[model samples]
Target: MTFPKRFSNLPEYAFPRLRRLLDCHGPGGAPLRMSIGEPQHAFPPWVAGIIAEHAQEFGKYPPNDGTPELLSAISDWIARRYRVIVEPDSRISVLNGTREGLFNAALALCPEEKAGHRPVVLTPNPFYQVYSVAALAVAADPVYVPATAETGFLPDYGALAPDLLDRVAIAYLCSPSNPQGAVADKGYWADLLRLAEKHDFQVFADECYSEVYRDDPPAGALEVADEIGADPERVLVFHSLSKRSNLPGLRSGFCAGGPQSMSRIRQLRAYAGAPMPLPLQRVAEKVWADEAHVEENRRLYRRKYEIADEILGDVPGYRPPEAGFFLWLPVEDGEAAALETWRMTGVRVLPGAYLSREVAGENPGKGYIRVAMVAPEQELRHGLTRLRGCLFG
Candidate 1:
């Protein structure tokens, strides 16, 4: 059977495509994988103990929204991190992971049409792939706006024609943006929220990488929305323990917004959602309440940041990521850089093109490679040094 036409043009996923590009060539030295953004830093040691304590509850069905305690913990965390207060019962949906929430948001929210024509879903060109897929899944027009060095590594949705803005039904934004690692300041968020209001679209703020920064925390969409008195329904913020807690396998995350939007999303989820396991939910409750561990995680990333800067700081076109763990390194050609680095130095990294889409014959990621700063300190230093010599020297 022919697959849906909407999905016909979807590019191959990043990791698998990387394998295809590099697996055929044998490593020239000992292998060091810094390709995908999988965290190698230690999660809290207590995480496992908590899971063991609640292992018995795995058999029981989980709360569809969230346990009262878990919700309270999430609310407390948000209030602390973003200074945005939200009522759990009415505005939060405990997600299995942010990916589930991100993808399902489009399904639950995107309407059949906008402004009397096909609706548009805006995303950063070199974005988390889920955003485009979500738009396509809902039959909305996926608009890839470039988030390049020229745009402060954030998509300039405001530059789109006013007519196009009016047709936008949803806009997906990632702060501490993937690959680029640029954080959107409060001012940027306020402008976007205002644009959303004027254009009549929803904002999906993916702040999953918010906790992986060095200094001042990134300004959150909901935080700015509240400060500016934007409609609560206009923005939905998704956060997760994956990057923050380095518990990617735990698959725990959440979505928070206005009660009305939460109601519609929760309704869709009740029919098609994988609620977090009751035991996992209990673990999340404790995880969310703790700040010590989160701080430690941040400290580790901070060190890596220094290491990266010291190594590549002087390289031409080397833009130090403002936040997040990935390094978006510049090169003449991303694919060539990745392949040669793997073959000569045995350091594996992802080509930037994999994360972007070409519009008007220009793929924003074509001249870069994405390296994950998730390896151990010494190993990361060696790997990056090798990469530097192989790709740049």
Candidate 2:
């Protein structure tokens, strides 16, 4: 039997590749995992109580778009976070998780072809794997652009040829970027918004890490999009409670965009998407309305940030990220550093190259490792100290 060719060219997904590379090896000391970005902070204590209180609703089908209460909560959070008002009915759609929305948006909106040719979807190197897969799922050409130290660890979309731009249907951008922790500033957002306007492409902003930061909160794409008077449908921003609210298991997130685009997305979701359970949506509504838990979560991450800075600060090429819980550290070779750390200290971190694809003979993440700061403070300290002693010592 023949399989689809689209799936043929893609490399194995990151975790499977990591297991192949590391599962054979045994930890040399007490094991400490800093590889994946799963949060370890305490999720809100009230979550279980809330879910139990509303459990009866589980027997009924959930609202396909969102319940009024859930939509209102999401809209309120957007206003509080970005200072931009989004109408519950028109601007917001509850997602199973941001990844679902991010991938499906491409299918629901991308045309079969663009500019009389195959469409292109631009994504940053070291990107969340979903971006490239979404491009391929839609049969569009996925273009990986380098987002390395030389580029402030962010891709330069403006450098692509005009002809390429003309064929671009969408561009996926992650601020407080995954693995890299590079936050795009307001100016960066503005420039990208302008480029999208000029070239006629949509921007998908993955902001799941917006709440985890070192200092001032990271600037958001919607704010900048509004500031520039860009077309409302030109940008769709995805946010998740997974990192921000320490509730990954809840699988709640949202997508906000212009009325027409969101309508199309909602229509597609109506046919293929699973709505958040009614009870879960109730809990999420309350979670979104409250900031106290989020503040506490951020405080926990901040301490870990300081500990990492103190431990790894003096090392060459160590720059703390402005936002997000991962540290992207420079090394001579990412895979070598990862293996060495795992072999010597039992500290497992992801090689940055695994998070990125090679483009133009250079993998943007070829010489770095991504350490998740999502573990407990003491655990993080141990992992960092182990990592420092094993890899940099």
- Kindly give the number of clashing pairs for every candidate: 0, 0
Native RMSD of candidate 2 (Å): 0.9
Per-model TM values vs. the true structure: 0.99, 0.99
The lDDT for every candidate, in the order shown, is 0.93, 0.91
Model 2: per-residue lDDT, tens digit, 121-154?
Answer: 9999989999999999999999998887889989
Q: Clashing pairs in model 2? A: none
Tens digit per residue, CA lDDT, model 1, 69-150: 9999999999998888999899999998899999998999999999999999999989999999999999999999999999
Candidate 1 least-lDDT 10 residues: 384-393
